[model samples]
Target: MWSSKYSEDIKEKVLEMYLHGEANVEKISKRYGIPASTIKNWISLYWEEEQARAERSKAASRRKRRFVNGKELRVVRPTSGSAYIDWRRK
Candidate 1:
């Protein structure tokens, strides 16, 4: 698909204007010379991206960071009451 020459800042500003009810698609279309359909597309795309980002953050927050199935390190005491370092995995 061919991309527009308009910068992201301009697109974002247009989207904000439309989303905030400051202007309608047709009004913005006239002011910025962008098609109404293109503005609508940007709005939908932005919404989808925001939803995906929210879901990703929620998933990340739901995960655990604790050790899972890893070997533990500790000191061992024998019958002779001598403490020795145990570096073997059990």
Candidate 2:
């Protein structure tokens, strides 16, 4: 694709502008002399990449929460006992 011919830096800026409603594909294409389809492709690619990143981040946070909440680490000491072995719940 013609868009692939451009450098990563250029494509990233184009994607940012498109995402923020600062510019549409046609406007950016005309301004940069790139193809409109290329701009559209860049925008699509950017959104897909961002969605995947968000999903991964959400999964990581869920795992951390489960690990922290599911484990019981508190320790309780046993009280004094007589001749017979006995256990009591506090």
Candidate 3:
């Protein structure tokens, strides 16, 4: 059975190998005995297509509505882990 947890270093190494064209996920999975699905997940998480990357950048500046303390507020939360709420925006 494969270990349930793998270190970040190991993941980085695998990602690098894949990105560098050393091998595709199936080959890497077989070589390292890891599941191909797991490697694919890492690729999706780490590698964004250009359109997706741009969309993500746009979303960072977008404001979404949320209810906080019985008030509908527009919250602009960037990917930077900070949030600001505009109560008057609604």
Please tell me which predicted candidate would have the highest lDDT against the true structure: 1
lDDT of 2 by residue, 13-56 (tens): 88878878998888999989999977777777777888999999
Worst 10 residues of 1 by lDDT: 64-73
Q: TM per model?
A: 0.65, 0.63, 0.50
Ranked by TM-score, top first: 1, 2, 3
Which residue pairs clash within candidate 1? none
The per-model lDDT (C-alpha) reads 0.81, 0.71, 0.79
Ranking by lDDT: 1, 3, 2
lDDT (0-100) at residue 77 of candidate 1?
73
Question: Which candidate has the highest TM-score of all?
Answer: 1
Q: Candidate 1 or 3, higher lDDT?
A: 1
- What value of lDDT does candidate 1 attain over all alpha carbons? 0.81
Whole-structure CA lDDT of model 3:
0.79
Model 1 deviation from native, Cα RMSD in Å = 13.9
